[model samples]
Target: MRILSAPLLPLLVTFIPPHVTRAQTTSVVLPFRRTFSLSVSASPIILSLPAQNEPYWLSVALCGAILPYPRFFVSNESDVTLPGPGGVQGSQTGEELNLDEGLITYRAQMSSGGALAIWPSSGAGANWTIDVAAIQDDFPTHRRLSQLPLLGDTSATRALIFSPPFFTRETQEPIFPNYTFQDAIPSVPPIPSSAEPNTTLLLFPTANANATVWLTNSACALTSKLGGVMTTTATRTVYRDSSGWRRQWFVDGLSASTNYTAYVIENNAQVSGPSYLRTKSDSFPCPLAHSIPYCPEVSYAVPLPAPPGSATSYTDDNIPQDIKA
Candidate 1:
């Protein structure tokens, strides 16, 4: 008997599987979003300061858009001083000044409501003028509420004054630093980290509040062996991301899911945070975008089992008997 060999046919289609990444024990996280609610009107300027209020901090973002690292400061006085080394001699990549453009708004504690001016840290000469324009304001606000007498506390306002994109303009003048005001409390908060569990970040309450920030276990609860007291750097850390100041501190070690609190030992003590935060218990696996966590990345066909004693799981029995084998 003789047997004939057949030729194999080529298939027309092919399938490619999607890429899959293995899960890890650690993950990355981002800080909470900050709100810019501070708003004012320019139509009718409020020249006089509020008669019955406390001095507050003011934050300015110089050349906020153009400069690689815009100039900034948070001060309580009308004439504030910019932080970090002054002059072109020793400056970082983003510290260059472009006086003609940029913005300076009371975006922070601007609620105090007063005029603003600033000088470089290097010298006290040529204080720049910060022109803040508001859109709709009362026809005029009496310096004192008593002046409203017969009018009985009434005011008028207009809309669509300036074109759009209202901002602060800074123009330099050859004058010495002038004007002073009482100091006010700042309101910076602590930010959480995603890396090692033994770290904390402090956005100083005041620009110059370079004090120690202790990390202690919750006062209400017993201390966890995983961590103890932690402190910030001796000097202010110039964070590029902000014209404002920021710093990082190391903890002895942080225990997962443990409660802790942070506070400044000096400078500005008003912010006690009576505030506490709890550490996460597990290290989350950070994946790119696993919106559908259970979706499969690869697909395969079910392998048909051969007869109980067959050597392989492959068979052609499903083929019609009329077909060639």
Candidate 2:
């Protein structure tokens, strides 16, 4: 299924099977994740964007908190009954639709009383809305907004964290001759850059001859695959001196604490030795306590307490666990 437009009125989502394709589309799948308790008073529109074609926001996580189970359909639009005005008027709901090379991105909308909160999938989005008792179906979307500054509704509050967004491939690219027998090593810190700091930057790095998978792993075990794809060129790094391939593939859509299987399917024909990977937990900009695959450097932020000109002192209880570890 796929969604095309996100205007305030009649949000048009096409319920197409995964086997079909669409020529007119700009949809991207968002990595399944959570939204921490942050508030933003904007239009009632949620988008699922693939990392490769991410918009200017370039965000990694998202969440939602709705009430009365807004409304969704895989077949009949008229069958949907929303609390307020605004639904498929000119046409019937649940129109059979086909999709594209992109995995899927059907559509959804909110009622006047619905809330929007986001948090990581590891925890609830403040409270999970998608996992409510009223609804019991596994659709394409997850419930994860944790903080809605002034939300007043209460129905689905059990939050749900999610994995990263990705696109299902119709066929795999042919493996390069030089790409064979090489390992795809994942790297980030010990030696870091501004965009890829030792602990903060969420970008994952991996390289193997002409192919690179930023998802992390060991020197010989072949760690794993991270992120769907990046349109930009690969960057070279000398972080390891001369131990492995100098070229690096920085994957943008890496998922935290998730397992991925890596393999090469040349021209969708011959398959080679596949590698499995599991990414770290903590992520950039998320200061929550103890996210999986965590780094000891990150933590929930605390304001500096001592005087401006004084040397600061922090007790063991006040220190972040990761830093203390």
Candidate 3:
């Protein structure tokens, strides 16, 4: 089941306000609103909502007070009934929000109550506050907007933090003929190697070398007959280098705190060792208190006491936890 997941609807997500009480009433400016208290047991938990009379764009706000970095997937899918393994993918209709950062808007007009699926990218069960609203008016397109200024305070302060609006494209070229032993010699040889940051190795036979490589969280089984097919459902091809004669291959573009196994195949037969490598884990961005991977820098937020008759207030917090150094 190779699923090429693509965004179905135009979606935009805003960042959550710091330490806003879930019960705090919004100044009845938006048209429709709904709130729910949930504890996510496993990933891809689908929450159903009652449908509406007319088509309207929906805004989703999530608050994870206890989780370090909670990830969410919101879908108006007609049939997302159960939680699936791995993160949400191949959705015909849905949008994934940033981990821990809690705001998303989707252009949806629910004929009936739609479904929103939520999940954690890297944490155990934790408490979550979910808010959804149907914008009564239709906007031309989808994009993230800052929180509406409903609290009428002229002296209130606001600071905007921006991340790149586009995905970072990384292109990895094959590292060939490094100081590693060659494979495809019809014998299992000791491929002497040393660890390098964000890199791995592959060995191949120069004759039948049209090879492919895969990276996985766990070890993947290998077969002697090289499979000609490059695509597989179970694994993602991080690096694909053809022509086995390239002898020694070095693989790069790895992340820290991940265990990766590299498998090389040519024409349905395993040509190189299913070499395993584990990258060193980097330190968490937050203080030592909430140091786990899932913990966002939520504790660092200090609400500024607003002066009476002030319209705006500021909260001092560290950088976004997702923005690593």
Please name the candidate that would achieve the greatest lDDT relative to the true structure: 3
Per-candidate clashes, comma-separated: 4, 45, 23
Per-candidate local distance difference test: 0.22, 0.25, 0.33
Judge candidate 1 against the unseen true structure and give its global Cα lDDT, from 0 to 1.
0.22
- Misplaced by over 4 Å in model 1 are 1-228, 231-236, 240-243, 268-272, 285-325
**Candidate 1 Cα deviation (angstroms), residue 212:** 19
Off by over 4 Å in 3: 1-32, 40-45, 49-54, 64-68, 82-95, 99-101, 109-113, 121-126, 139-325
True-vs-predicted CA distance for residue 170, candidate 2, Å: 36
**C-alpha lDDT of candidate 3 relative to the true structure:** 0.33
lDDT of candidate 1 over 15-131, digit per residue (tens): 111111221111111111111211111111112222114322222222112112223323233222222123323121222222322322232223333322222222112222222
lDDT at 258, model 1: 54
- Model 3 sits at a Cα RMSD from the real structure of 27.2
**TM-score for candidate 2, residues paired by index:** 0.17
lDDT of 2 by residue, 98-150 (tens): 21111113343321112121111211123322211111124333222122111
Q: Please estimate how well model 2 matches the true structure, expressed as its whole-model Cα lDDT.
A: 0.25
Better of 2 and 3 by TM-score: 3
